[model samples]
Target: MDLSRQRCRLWKELVLVASLLALGICQASGQIDINPDSLIGVETYRTRLVLENVTSDSQQNGPMFTGRESVLKTGDLHIRGSQLNDTGNYTVRVDAINGTQRATGWLKIQELEIPGISVNATSVVEDIDSVAAICYTNDTNVMWYVNSAPVSSNNRMTISPDTKTLIIQRIERFDSPLQCSIEIIPEIFGRSELIQLTVAYGPYGMTLTSMPNHLSGVVSAEIGTPVEMKCTAYSRPESQYRWFHNGSLLSFSGENISLPSLTWDQMGSYRCVVGNSVTQLTFYQRLQVQVPWRPKPAQKRVFTVSGSYVVVLIVVTVLGGVVFCATLIYILFKHYSTRTNRLI
Candidate 1:
């Protein structure tokens, strides 16, 4: 009886060991799990596959696993090549002492497509209340750069809503050639093309004035007499005119002198100084005063009526006496002549 029991016990132990070995073989033969089946147009991407044993038996065995020469044991599989034709599907197989497992994946290579770009505006004006527009083509987003640095967020530099152009408003005189670029993707470090711009300075210095350098006039008792003085000057910065007399500035406030009052005090050398910030010029005119002449009592009148009457009386009396004598003599002569004639 003892011998028979020992044989049975030994046989049961051997069967248990065989069953465990079989289970271990099934576990090693399970499928290998790869997350993705294929990859297309990928550049420098990581590939990974999970080796899974579905059987419940836990046992270690030597397996001949096959994979691409570039594949890693734990981390992602890295694949790199210059052209698209260098891509191919990769299959990994694991073979144990009892069974085998397999996993497959594909990688497709592609070349980066960089878009063409161009800039329109070449020159810009500065220091004035003006805006400059820059146009671009065949780009995703327009980026504005000034002297190679990005422009500020201030309203002066802004991107248009359409994303096709950039506007710079109220540019300063000191601002230089504002550089600009278009970026397709920031991470990809992809750039289209380079462009340059030039900034220009000033249409400065303007001046203005009237004609006729000299002015003359006369004063009279007539009320509201109009006297006009011409104003004239020249300058580059656009001079403005202001009339002055006796160091006092004249106003165009009223009808006379274009001011409220034209009193005597307002009369003097009138000067008009024309100038701007850059240069100055001056003009001048003289004014004179006049009065009516009057006579004095000391100077006597020549030929009065009394002297004329006395001279006339004396001349009349002398002429009368001469006439009487002549008449008397004539009568006597006449009497004698008559007697003689009778005697003859």
Candidate 2:
């Protein structure tokens, strides 16, 4: 009876060991986590273990070395230098004496955070060829985008031989907001901060504008009235203004100037020169000043009002003329009367 009891105890010990081994198999079916850019190894205690890196055939397209093939090895699978594409579920199978056991669980692949980026030249001439922008990271296969569109090898833009640099030949207006995105395709993509590019060009249509703008590039006003004029130009970088009068610098720096009064000397050639620092371009304009004709002064006139002196002079002249006329008439009448009476 004691021997039979010993046999029963041995059977119970063997069954307990088998139960523990089955529990370990169930635990292996659960999720297994790992980060990229490091080494990872998954092991199972079984007669034979097979691991299938089936990400390429499945929904995932992450970069992986094994592609879509399976491997049979001693109960352990080793992966070296993992990347973004190594993420997803790995098929685990165990071939035991009883039967074959299979399970699926996640193998997490954490991505490397995107880093800061820079451009060789933020601003380039409008017609300049060969504009380069580099994405700074140790990661491989960086993609570039312009205005939210994928950039590929073409006449307008091309990728470098190493695929680390993006070259844009003959920049265009839409080249602003250039970006670099790092991803393994289909999923797991991180974009760098946007880096804007400016196209430097001309300082065109230079003119002297005023409140009234007496004329194009000319400011005219009354000689004593205050007059103000502004120098204006267009360019990628704003142009600087300089004012000169008769070959003499009137202002060192300013966009606009005010004149208190105009004189004969100030009525000569007035020039306004504009310069663009980016394009190294300089242009100037000259304005002529003329004075209007002035009218001559008028002659002076005199007037008087006196009554007594005028009356006395008029009466004396009339009385003397009357007396002389009467005396001459009396002598002539006496002579004429005597001759006429004798004849009758």
Candidate 3:
């Protein structure tokens, strides 16, 4: 009987522990659950609130908050045709059978206005003109981009205090297609149309080339041979060309000129003038066109024969003088020997 009483006491303690666990679980699950902590709202769009462990006695308090009935209790709050005025904090209180629970959420509505950009001039000369680009928007925060890269203030570029205007003291050709962008919401941005610039640049690096024959700025062509000349220069706008002969301008005006037949009259100084109307720059180059001097076939033969006869005559004279010197030496040695023998 004492053992049976001890077992009964243990059973009662187990029942009490199980009841306490049940109470703790009810308290924990009774807290309200909001599916999302924040939401982005747009006009004429629909949104629904998801709630857990809430009863029909629950009430939602916020701008434009509505509700519908569910099988278990009053269902989630439904917002139809949300607007900017409906953007605010929302609170829900539930009078559940277990206890009272509360939850709060946020709804943010975005402005759909886009930004614009304006420039003082549509075209400017590179390194010779200044430009002012302004971002037009209600928001003061702004950013600038050139060729799809971020722009920073330098010795020639500056940004306004509010960052709305960008001033370039000396614009370059690479700084084109400027764009201005602004952020309306986190990770949401609005950009303006691209502003393209027409930058006028130089006419430089003058060059003149000849077809068929050219040697160190001199054009050599046979008589009656056709010669073609081409001139080139680097410029933003294409360079204009003019040809001149012996300081007198020819009637031709282009990058290429042709001399149909080379003659003595064509053998003079030829000049090519390259100029740019936009940049107001000019370059000139001079090339001498000449027919090289060469002897006729008959004259060349006569000269070759004369040179050979002179060389042969010199060789024969040297050999004859050497023979005569040897003979004189032999005669002198014979006479000296005959005299010595007589004396002995």
Q: What lDDT score belongs to each candidate, Candidate 1 first?
A: 0.44, 0.59, 0.71
Per-residue alpha-carbon lDDT of candidate 3 for residues 122-238, written as tens digits (9 for 90 to 100): 778777899999999888888889878988888988989899999988888888888888876665667889999998877878889997667888887888999899999887878
Cα lDDT of model 2 by residue, 1-344, tens digit? 12112111111111111221444332223322222312222211111123332111111122332432222222233444454444445444443334444444444345445746788888887666357888877668788888889878898788887667888888865688878877633555667899988877667788776544556545555566666667788877778788898889984677787777766666666788988787788898877555544678896876654688668767777887888788889889998999999999
Clashing pairs in 2: 62-85, 63-85
- Count of backbone clashes for each model? 7, 2, 0
lDDT of 1 by residue, 16-86 (tens): 11223444333343455545665554333333333344333232222322222233333234343334443
Candidate scoring better on lDDT of 1 and 2: 2
Ranking by lDDT: 3, 2, 1
Q: Tell me the lDDT of candidate 1.
A: 0.44
Decreasing TM-score order of the candidates: 3, 2, 1
TM-score of each: 0.32, 0.47, 0.59
Model 1 steric clash total: 7
lDDT for 31 in candidate 2 is: 26
